[model samples]
Target: MKTMILTTALLALTAGSVSAQQVVRLATEGAYPPFNFINDAGQVDGFEIALFNELCTRAEVSCEWVTTDWDGMIPNLQSGNFDAIVAGMSITDERREVIDFTQNYYPPAFSAYAAMDPDADIEGGVVAAQTNTIQAAHVAETGATLLEYATPDEAVGAVRNGEADAVFSDSDYLKPVVDESGGAFVWLGEPVQLGDGIGMGLRKSDTELKATFDTAIQSMKDDGSLNALLTEWFGGDDAPQF
Candidate 1:
């Protein structure tokens, strides 16, 4: 999943409440590139990192980054481990049942299939997807045998190593791989749009923080800064602007 990936166990939600904390801690997967990833400096870097900092500045809110594994991301947030999550997580109805999300920062993107073999059977063959992602859910409905991986990289690796016929994921993440694979990878079929878009996930009670960030995000869009940031990270053509 490009825009959305990973699934976390549903741990018991702690009845924790946040007030005007001095430092607003935000977490990211630190694995999804162009959205969020660890850099050579061992720091979280990418579009979302840049966006978080800028948004915090605009909102006059003190904030810091926290790196967390994607598989248990939701549970950690629910348990008061972080103030928010912005790790390319999608805004879906099912997810909304667990947590609240601000307006989308990234527009909806199509999920596609990629494989070493061009004729890979995406319709009913073995398909790889990140565990509990929209892609995996979609694959399950497509009548394909879904292979779930804890990380998107592992899902792609399944396709590369012949463990899966094709891997279904967000095209933004896979397009670069296919373009740079030297013919080792090719798209298997048409892409399908999933989720509304990507957004910041917060606990249901964090309405004030959500309103603050939402206002900041809308300001960026109003001032044309959001479009510029989108272009900088995802290129003008592929990334949807405000």
Candidate 2:
């Protein structure tokens, strides 16, 4: 949820300040399905991708999509590799010290443990989580030993391979996995709510750009389009509305 890196697709540009004239280069992990991922067509496609396209349209700005490694994402942003990160990054005080965030695009998420064994001791068991996520942060303070992976798939794989007792992650990301697991994987314990929610990460100096996207986000919220998109991607059972 915190990072990713990939190639850039050329679109349009102007580039003096972050406005309609400039082709704003936006970054995403392109690995988290339903949120952001590389589709079979080998293009970035997901709920966030659709939302970004809409936000850019609303802000009247042209944008190009890019992907980058999760761990290096924030640093890459500061280095000007992209204009903003639309990846599913949680809004937290630690991140705020280095970058600013617009109002949340996704609501606070429930993090849960998934394991093949229903009786797995999540309290003191070996647990895997994507590095830099709020799920990983929660695990680090628990009786469970934390194993951080660079990607969400790897964290889930740890449980399948017996490298960890369970995988902890955003339930939205985990739900589809479990459903597709054919009775092999099951949710392990009570879902834990973590982070303030998902938001776009921007440089502090990009105040104008932040304002632009924020206005677009609120407009979607007010119009019910945001909720419709959320349900479409994540399902009505779990998708939270404004």
The candidate maximizing lDDT is 2
lDDT, candidate 2, 12-85, per-residue tens: 44343355456788988888888999988788999999898888777777778888878878988999988898
What clash count goes with each model?
Answer: 1, 9
lDDT tens digits, residue span 31-77, model 1: 88889997886777899988877887777766767777787788889
Instruction: Give candidate 1 misplaced runs (Cα > 4 Å).
Output: 1-21
Report the error of model 1 at residue 99, Å.
0.4
| Model 1: how far residue 206 lies from native, Å | 0.6
lDDT of each: 0.84, 0.88
Model 1 CA lDDT for position 51: 88
Once all C-alphas are superposed, what RMSD does model 2 give against the true structure?
Answer: 2.8
Q: In candidate 1, which residue pairs get closer than 3 Å at backbone N, Cα or C atoms, i.e. clash?
A: 2-170
